[model samples]
Target: MKQWWIIICMILSPCLKADNLFIEAESFDKKGGWVLDNQSMGQMGSPYLLAHGMGVPVENASTLLQVREAGEYRVWVRTRDWVKQWDKPGSPGRFEVLLNGKALRTTFGTEKAVWHWQDGGTVLLKVGENSLELHDLTGFEGRCDAVFLTSSLDLLPPDGGNELADFRRKMSGLPAEPEEAGEYDLVVVGGGMAGCCAALSAARLGCKVALIQNRPVLGGNNSSEVRVGLSGLIASQPYPNLGNLLDEFGVVGHWNDWEAKQDPSSARSKQIREILQRHPEKKIHNAGPATNYEDEKKQSLLQGQENLSLFLNMQVYDLRKEGDRITFVIGKSIISGKEYIFRGRLFADCTGDGEVGFLAGADYRVGRESKDETGEPRAPLKADRLVMGTSVQWYAEDAPDRSGFPDCPWAIRFTEETCVPATRGDWDWEAGLDRDQITEIEYIRDHALRAVYGNWAFLKNQSSKKEQFAGKKLAWVAYIGGKRESRRLLGDIVLREQDLLENISYEDATFTTTWGVDLHYPKPIAGMDEEPFLSYCDVQEIKPYAVPYRCLYSRNVGNLFMAGRNISVTHVALGTVRVMRTGGMMGEVVGMAASLCKKFDTYPRGIYEMYLPALQTLMRQGVGKPGFPDADKLD
Candidate 1:
């Protein structure tokens, strides 16, 4: 009799009354054409589901919700009007909510620039499973963070920022303290080519490593999400064997157009054809195939190492510091609401934003430094907010039949005078150099999107070449913004342009940088009313210079190390070292330094001061696989 009573109670428990229910949009089982976007979490407070319709309305996003009571519940949704910044009359990101196959009276995603609650009148929910759906009304970009249903008439949705963050944690029933992920000798934040090499190099040397990336994929810029072809020469001059690991892990074949045309006269073309013949599964086309991003290949390589652990979709938000050292970092999954605490003796800040260094209170700089500050002639006479712009590359496909694109009124308008008569958006298509790349990332990305959509609309509908583009359809546009520069974490030595021009050698030199000082600016094109999306670049070649080990670690933070574009360099010097391949070599050197830290039981500064000779010996011997022909060589 007691067992029967307990079973009955267990079945009846869900039917009991409750005050409220919270549903995170990202946690929905069936996303259906919606993208999980966590890029604005720092500013908006939580990851949201984005219906990034490029002028065509996407399918509805539905989720199953269990109600505790069958009664009238007030509905509230968190969203924003993305185009509100333009002070536009109509909201581009408008959507509707449906409950149990019935459309609600209120329309969502019409709020202003800030994230807020949009009231959806009373709804009748049953005391069982109910279908909750998000219907995009416009073919722009509609976003939904979370939905809240409450019985109390006075209860309102949580406001944005820290309050919203705390409310999310409470609503999600996440633990108050972060769960211990694991202990490691080294923890690397950022999963770009640099971070991957750093973690792999350290792990191969028998150090336990934890590589945490905010995105679902491993590579950052090089990943399929961004699709930037690797540039700059690796395994050259000063350190011949330093970048051998890069060839082992990097994507094979250059993005040269000749390779796609199969021109036997070009050496690269013949080599690519031979490679494809050997491995038919690998495709080599223009800018290489989408597979060249190699998401699985990177994951497989990291998983093969027993000492290394890869954590994807984990965004590090906070860190615990003991004096000058970082003890552990706090990360939260973009998919799930679970929080993680990763403890390590050493930490590498490969995040291009320099997030770890910023959190640890390490000194850093943003934008361009004046000529007086670094004595670089190319720098501005007076310091101002001007840095290399971010890129949003895109491509189009030829359709057998003519295709039409909708007119995007909300996007930046382009006239025939300003129409770019091209089907591909390469490195030149860039913007947002004057804005804050870290805090204003969403705005920058949105601006790029507007540029692409607006320009394509003009070409297809209004431009003189409309007939030419009629048969072409928009194929792919990178949603992940390819950032060129951000916060430069200060180190013991800040590399300057003079170092590369004079070919100065340091005792702690590890890798060689062959790329010239390449900087970007928004140059005016004839007949354009406003600034063009395409950027103008200026390059000055210098002798192959060795990068110092002193520029790899933080000066103030004892256990902190950094690589990639965030390394210590002047705005002028960063022009050369910011290339992906050069950054990958920097990562290898940092990885070696991390292994040395473990062996000597010391910090980054200690490795430079006390054990300089040992590091030189390791650099001389090299850590990467030998005998693999150097794929990228300088003239």
Candidate 2:
């Protein structure tokens, strides 16, 4: 990468004095050069007060205005006492100022009586037109009565100037030397629920296990980042014993048809609600719902486990092996920019994206298998051209007492489509506000939030039931994208949709995923009105399918195993396994099989033959019914 720096200077005519151009605001309630960004109201599609008017304190209120002429200047202001309930120590009541949108160090600590303007803050005014801003960091408690500007520019080194430069310098430095990852009996990549369970299960067996998680936080889609609730089988038939371990670990919550109580009842609210109501006992939370994996560490949930070592924010960069004997692996950290080298006897590819298998030179499939490849009825004659796109979500709240629309940053198309009134059962998935291109995904998500707020404004101001939308508001915008599908790894056994619906039970079955066979098509391609194409196979439901251990291991890389949606399956088969519970179970099995391999000092494939009894023992300990119960139950 290259760097560039450029600066422009404008000279002012002598007749134009520095004193002529200055804008000031005494309050924010009425046209004081302030606007409420009502795009997100708290997931409720409504508007609320933006600044001092809303319940939010005014001490940290931000104000921006233009000044036509520039000169060295002294800026001062008075502020009332900040409300202590929301203020913390060392926090100035009238905090921070900005020049030309860049923040300046300006503050009035809460020490004296009301409205006392202090002195001694100045900045060098560049020789042209400039913008001056005063930000109310504490919440603008006292009124901002007036402004003072002078020709004396005292330019001190800007705050955060070196801090930012240091950050950039650090980012450019070479990453740390890779850690020496010793020969792990079993190495599991990806740290979602399944991967976590797998790591713990193997470690508990006295096997030295290394768990690699690409993300800082685990739980996969069910994690707080993606926010997709878990749903799928709790126990494979006759395997209630297999489901016991997950049940003990809060995995039983996804079986419900109703939404988790913590879920927001916005556009897709009904769908979530329906799921939760249908399955009342599933474990779920709405807010602070374990979105961060570091939270798990604080709780000490996995502490004191001798066998497992969970590495966060680390990604598999490469894998080295010959024939079936895998030797070592390479990993890189996303944050500290560190790399690691791990030598493991057996590895599991739970990265969901199949990063492990792919790096190990495994044969993988990126799209749907042709009908000729699977012989499944619903298989397309050829691969479909489009793939599912990812989505980000937002939240909003309604205005109090059905007020007029707030000055939110709503797009033109949003205001046109968001004129509806709020009613019970009014939210719809189809009510979003943009096209379906990947480049425009964020555009749609933002507009969707804006549309929700705008419609709520209409409800509060003009709709027949304005009274009903009085207090709803948008609260949050999910920090991460909710992805649906991506690359998949080819394994020793390729699972077809026909095998699922036909209920083919493999002798080497490790777990079963019961989410209904489902598939989503990209919105109709341009110039075509009907769906681009749909097969009878795509249109129908398939029965629960048993996943064999073989499908989780690589065809090319012997020591690598895969879990989650990236397993060897046609696109149609992935629709079922993509759900949270199934992914979790897959991780659990992979971990246990890895442990079994470590105990035998062999690879994952060896577990099926030489360590079948121990694998059975692990299955009996995990979720799903223990297959071949008479053979060997894991102690």
Candidate 3:
């Protein structure tokens, strides 16, 4: 693995002085309807604006630019043909770069599959402020990273390399040194359930904490952007209050068909209605709607905290380390290219991909473990990179009028034989099972998009039951891929599936996990061979078992603590512990341990070695208010 110091200098670098005129699409004053997507910034080189209009073209995004050299400058847009990788037919991501109310001659996003500078010929710029617009032709998913304008046509921006990275620093006029974002007692990365709980717990315990989230919202998969419902049982057995923090902020657990609940003719509708009758809070469901996730509630909780500070749209690319301990971390705002340097005492790797641990050179494992290695029955014979897939969940709803959907020849083609005839695609609509979940995530997400649009196009146009779908239009499709498994940061004890199956107990056990060991595999469709778009799962049920405290903190990296799916566990054990609720409980335990670290003046391991009793007391008492069904009970 490349050291964090060497790899992330481009993104980590920030500046305020620039000789060249460069317009980052993310910095656009009026985004209109385009969304800022920093999820694939590492691979694509920078965060970009995504026009996710479902099937309808979105309103144009515009920004005013001040040009010092007002003249005919060669225009270049950083974009790509999103579906060109598979040699697909049409360009779904095609868009135009406009200058001062006039569209450019060349159409962008119709060229290379990889991120490249598409020449828009030359455009005239005013002496003062000029109106720049990104006109989206098709809202399928048009992306624009940055727009460059130089007097010299020969001076083309390098596609992607160390040179291009350095050029970005030069063009952005960012200074070499980073601005300080203040020191903290605890720093929690990744604003998912685990990170949120970790920050909340630590903050409530009177530790000045910093919670950094790449996206604008808090919850990762469970956020409105992704819309995955929280799963697994919370508040189980000893230290029942471990998950109590979740209750303070509403984290919905139930996963019922949202549409079916509203349908009087549907069988499950009655059951759903009855559930809601008893508890109106049961309105939440997987991929239900944007309102179902209640992102604002989570945001309010984080903002209301006295000791906790929230840093949204700040993606941490690199960290500074003193020996084994991380001294500070460098994160840049996705919107403004300014750097944020957070110095902290103890750091938590709640980033589900184990990003902090990976950057810190902590011992970690990716993919499945061999059966011989873990002695687990479910472990594969040979170790392989077959981790669980990423889900781009989608759903369609009845439109006010008969809706029209364009043919998606550029997307994955589907026929009656291969198509999944359903209005809503759930967790099973997964892709990139065989690909690297980290490096190749853009492809993974795009593959899922191709499958979704292709299937939707078929269902809307060519399916035998096309009349049944004529009234329905695509409502919401998650752009942010909800990941299941990734890099597992290794710790003092690597929990195995056999431990839960055999009901093994640990003296230092902290949080309890009750989710089944559910692992996903490709569904094996008839026609799809290039990339499987659907998946099936093999669920191995496990009793509520407490995870050892040793699994929470890193074995090699001294001050780091981990939660979420990235915790120290074999592929088999990740099945049970990967669920959001289980991960949240882990966060609660981690937070309690973090407070202990500050109090005893010790690291994460030292808390276990010297002050395990203190952590236990904190867990038993808990941080959240009781009687709200205990930490919003994930199950």
Candidate 4:
């Protein structure tokens, strides 16, 4: 009877044959310029790869696959023709797939708008390691999600939605629930300068912290990836030690010296040139110090902390909430496709987009508020959709000889009158303020790229000063767009512009914002052709004002804390507090609050209401490096 039962089980079991191979494009071993874009996951089904060709075809992305069986297998790729949604003609993004050393006949990035599997003819594979490469044919932003290889020729890949997610999980052999990562006192999402400071401060205060970042590097906007300089004041009156962490991690000198009141041909230019010559490897065209060593220094500091566990290239997508508190967060490794379940007593939403708070049903606001709502003079009369735009900064280097640039007819056209004849695309080159900053990030980024390519082409080919630019070659253009504003999580006290203008002081004041009410709007240039990408700044300077602790934690979410640009503030007030230095101070204050939470075994509201004195004590003591010189101050 036992022998008969064993034979029957063997006959009925479905795991007798070999499984097919599935490779997620974002998990490729070598992903050159192609970036992992997960912003549109809700609409696209899953995170995918974006070539982000800023007018030039980026490098190819390749991955190695170890075949289990030597046999013929059919190939299918999940992709979409992105521009097709606009009802536009011609596919801007076109690319081919290479197997081993040969190219597949089927070209990708030319399909319909909706994501679906495009069939690539069957190919023979040997029982060994095979090379798969995404060869980009155009410098025009090709994209892919995953590649599916199956022995059965008739097997169709899942279309999309939850089914596609399930298919990916099954093929990748991932469990339904993510593997237990570990318990932590605080889990801080986003590895921007603010998040970094928060994690470091919490760890210093004896809390086991998990710092999860979507990108490979720390310092979101200030990192080499985005290259925006830190602004606003640090180590101001109320809290002298608040920005010690910022000073330890920030670049020493000012970046926009040419834009200052001083003349461009001053001795400062010569001094800067000499400094650049000393470090030729760091030659960044108009941008000073392409890579900041301070980021590396901060990463080292975080790693040295025994209580803080840093997880790079991990994007937190979902959270498990028990009532108002977040029990755990689910993050997927961008390179390995492995899910990590980060359990924690408290969570910090330092993500500039306020994504974690949005996921947890925290009250938030986006775009501008009306005069009736905010009661600020700067507020719009009838709050229309207008938010601060993102910047895609670029620069060019003067070659020894003449350099030729290809005419990008696919890009938005720019005439001589509409072109910006500058070598560097600085802070003023901003766009996408009218659209959804978070949901339409890819579009915003691509539009900025189009503006850059179009303007450059005009300068090289049609402008009267073409002779002057003939020897210049485009050196660098940031594919990772530096966003300015997004969803601001609502807190107990929504800091208003009146608070700063009137110099109202709160008893729970932690940090001071020194920047002016700097807002951005489209510049009115003569003979403008398309949507103006370049923005003009409108500044309303005010004295440095203290930001209160009540604006650091979510009002509704029990254990939620926030920092960075997403902290509770009116649009007018955000104009002053959104800068990196001020945001870093906010992170410092939240870190102190987190420590108090751990000490008292309470939530964020509890710290604000019942244990305010304890938090104030920590603020007075400060959590930064002891005896650090107060070099950074508000003028």
Candidate 5:
């Protein structure tokens, strides 16, 4: 019995050691530890150097040292420069290194381009490793990977010293800040499909552009965070280019690869191809779930060849103008509590909420306009009567061996007396979730998704349907609501249902939207007592509608441009034009117009009278067909 007790004590001794091993890497930067020395770089504030590298790096090119724990450690790295000299043609690049407050006498060689830390040379680190950092002044360079060490067993080599050094050089001399006094040539607000194109267009045309985006991710609703598939028409007989350049950036392979396996006649495949052909250099921006834009400098197109910069995490607090010509925009960062003063020659209010135009003394309206306002029979007799309420759509994932029957908040409401007999919720009034009021949509969607999870769990553990969903898992919950419609900024041209149904085309038309006036019922019970949910539409056949250039610019503000569902449209008509594909087209047109504004040094309105030809040419190159010089198409 005593021997058995000794054996048990011996087994537990390893679990109860004197001290467990841990490691921690440190540096002075935005991260707490070692701060960088940028006095030689003319930095007024303590700006820590951010790293850059060519090719996709495992961590951020900005990430120098990744520490897992705290303990005595040995850290070693090999680096190289791009300079191929007579002495060593491919030697390690020039690099700066600091280990434990001591600079190492390490000259980089190019021969070790593929080197990892364990290959002969490694850095030594002490317990509670205080500081270890390398500055790659450049943004992103070629072959810069790092390996940190707390123990000899955990050592690995570093690669691409010259590439890292090049990154450092680029980071050393920062671009001069925008002239604090003068107004910018063009100011684009929003970073969705449209806003991104608009800023790129204006910048390409040599206009100083300041793109203001509120969302952390640039692609807006189509982003992974938003989790919606990209929608647009491809350039062919029926499809025109919709502003889908950003979506193309995130595409891994051809859409046909997936579509061919599912449906060969899928038109969505062709549309995706057209978008990819136009913008091949699309870059993906993943903001994760519920990400907040921290620094505009880090995320925006701040490094434009001309003077286009993005300000993220910054909210446009107010708008100030001089009579008709807009003057300045005041914004503040929610994180830093810093203020930004943007003075632009022309302003574009691309805020989906039309916040900029609404604040800039521009006239706007919410809901449907009456027949008197826009002589359309479909228009409600009462002006501003019925607006498209916002929708909150959500999705649920099935679990593996699904046995988690979580309870739904609205489960009590789902009594057999109230609901129709159905297994899963669908687009019907029967067992489908109910969302009557705009204010209640969020609550309804939340509860609906919750109910889905709960139902799955009940089937797995409690319900008789356990055999069906034995192994299912609930994947995720959408934190942000899929907001449908909001305030529309009054533009130079008010689009009506007639423009869509009629064969009318302006010489300065930018893109065409083909979706019909599709509207949903107010509530499940409002229009349906004996039936389920129903969608109504006046037009049965699908026909393309022309969206003119005038619709993109504000009626009142000089520089303000508009896009997405907030563009000028009658309530009934907005039902059609507010589709995501139409939004992409609007964005592309906005981008092209912004470029034209920069090229011709003209206001957005001026493009209608002056640079119409240039705008047409841009469309021809981008979307495959310019809307102008073909008035017969309208006939």
Candidate 6:
């Protein structure tokens, strides 16, 4: 984190309005130990710096501030005490803003449960250049959004809404309009398995494509940050070649080279056998090590595409629609605060959250539908805001030496009765089921963090079997929450449980969904009172079924396409198709459709209405080779 090279040149412009100097924490030159967390950028305004040291306080995050006036500047730091909602004991996310090595009079992230500006009294500074450091007090999840230094005594920052947005824009000196990011035939607004495949598939079919991901990496849930292995059987019939590109994508050369080899003596078969035999520890679902996901390989795979332009660390927040069809989408960099515009003929919302579709005024649904409406056996009696929870997966490994963890009275405590009786967390360790998955994501993630730390603290400090956990230390606890269900974008047909159970096939059947109808709910724990941290998965066994192409394209939005968990589906149907592998197949189909649209100058609906045969031909024979354009094409 040697940040001296990142010179803080703010307050240098003469056209600036006020003497107030505002700096987004993510813009720091050298972040040192702190990580950029923009998951809650929609809820909160800007991305902030998070001190995710687990229990141990990380190294200092230093930055050089160019102070113009250098007088008595009243400092205000935007932050929140994440665990304060439960009204727990300790302030785990406490930190201080240091100016010129002198700690501020006020410690931030100690009070407000919601995001607010915490006044750090006054600090005297020298004119030219000054040192700014975010001093972390607890290794827990401390956060700082932006550091505000103003000569004004009475003016305070807006909590949120349009006022705060305009205030930050004018003060931070960001452009009023977003920077243009070139036109494309297709713009996929996510970097998940579905989005990657959609972008790759379209690009391979000779369409100019743009793949935009909010995070620093390409893969969303399967990235090393989230550490979820690919699920659902790939390369299934009616179109066995729908996932050929995905088959060639794996961490090591072993699985990446696999192509339905049956010969035991062949090198490819032997290599596949060896790698799977070696990496038995990596689970197929969640809570695996970082190396298993292969973020680098996925990044390289997308970047290697000839017609695909991949942009990481970019989040699409808004869109421009002429009538019902989307013309352009706007995204901003999560780290540098730079905004870019993506003008495209067709748009795809693979953002598990349906961000692009939502921006386009497309119809979408959240939570379960009433059984009366959907006629599904497992549907809730009433349509409510009870969606599936998100998982904050974690794991522990044997430490080199025995060490004791700190007491976490502020965290969710576990008695001997409520102790999970486990050293690691998996898909079951979920949170934020009842809350809004889109708006209150930060709250959802923070609650899971407390559960993880709290459960571990009990096992290590208070449980009768504490001796067993004495040698174990938390290796990884994913801060990037692996979400299960959220917004389900509505299409011409909303695939329901009956469709999968009855094996009803559509004329435009596309990808095969093999996973069972898996739905998750809050598990009832014995002693815990609040929303349960554990999840109870109620799964209904079902044979392989093909999903119609109607579910892939939007019903009203003319040019919009969708893939991933966000595709048109009932809450019940989402269980089977939401998995990464199945979503990848959806991307493959969407990408192929995007290519046909580019080739014919037709919309997403045109392919289903008139050009269905062409799409079927492309599906029968995929775009061929990972980055090879038109290797196996109908054009």
Model 3 stretches astray by more than 4 angstroms: 1-19, 251-275, 278-284, 629-635
Model 6: what TM-score? 0.93
lDDT of 3 by residue, 1-635 (tens): 23223323323223321224678899999999899888787777789999999878999999987765667888889998988888978888889988999999998899998889898998777777788999999998999999987766656677677767766666676776789999999999999999999999999998999999999998898888888888766657887767767766673433344433334674434644555665554565567778667688889988989999999999999998999999988998999888889999999999999999999999999999999888999998999999998999988988999999999998888888988889888899888889899899888999999889998999899999899999999999989999999899999999998899999999998888887899999877886665798899999887789999999999999999998999999998898899888898889888889998998899999988889889888888988776453222343
Order the candidates by lDDT, highest first: 3, 6, 1, 4, 2, 5
**TM-score of model number 4:** 0.89
Which lDDT tens digits does candidate 2 get at residues 1-635? 11111100111232223542222342222333223321221121112122332213343334343344555677654333332322333322344456667665655534443334445377666655565555554232223433445443331211133432232223224333557867788888877666766676667667788888766566665565555556665556534344444433333233333422323554234543554454443333322233322234411344546867778767676667777556888875544335688888777777665667766778887656778878877678986534443444333444454334443222212232335443321112121121332233323333333334434445555555555655654333343445555668887788878788888888788777777677665332234232221111233565656688788777777777777778888877877887766776777777777766666777766777678777777677663323222111111
For model 5, give the 10-residue run with minimal summed lDDT. 37-46
Flag regions of model 2 displaced more than 4 Å: 1-176, 181-183, 251-299, 318-327, 391-412, 415-470, 523-539, 621-635
The C-alpha TM-scores of every prediction are 0.92, 0.61, 0.93, 0.89, 0.57, 0.93
What number of backbone clashes does candidate 4 have, counting pairs of residues 3 or more apart or in separate chains? 1
* lDDT tens digits by residue: candidate 4, 266-285: 44345434544454443432
CA RMSD, predictions in order = 5.8, 14.2, 5.2, 5.7, 19.0, 5.4
Q: After superposing candidate 4, which stretches have Cα over 4 Å from the reference?
A: 1-19, 32-35, 52-58, 68-72, 85-90, 250-288, 524-526, 626-635
Give stretches of model 5 more than 4 Å off: 1-183, 236-248, 252-307, 408-412, 416-470, 525-540, 623-635
Cα shift from native, residue 186, model 3 (Å): 0.4
- Residues 405-479 of candidate 5 have per-residue lDDT tens digits of 433222222332333322333222112122332333323333333333334445445555556555544333333
Candidate 3 structure, TM-score to reference? 0.93
CA shift of 61, model 2, Å: 16
Best by lDDT: 3
| RMSD in angstroms between candidate 2 and the native structure over all alpha carbons | 14.2
Model 6: residue 241 alpha-carbon error in angstroms: 0.8
Cα RMSD for predicted model 4: 5.7
Candidate models: Cα lDDT each: 0.82, 0.52, 0.85, 0.80, 0.48, 0.83
Error of 6 at 552 (Å): 0.4
Tens-place lDDT per residue, model 6, 459-533, is 889899999999998888888899988899999999999999999989999999988999998986887786678
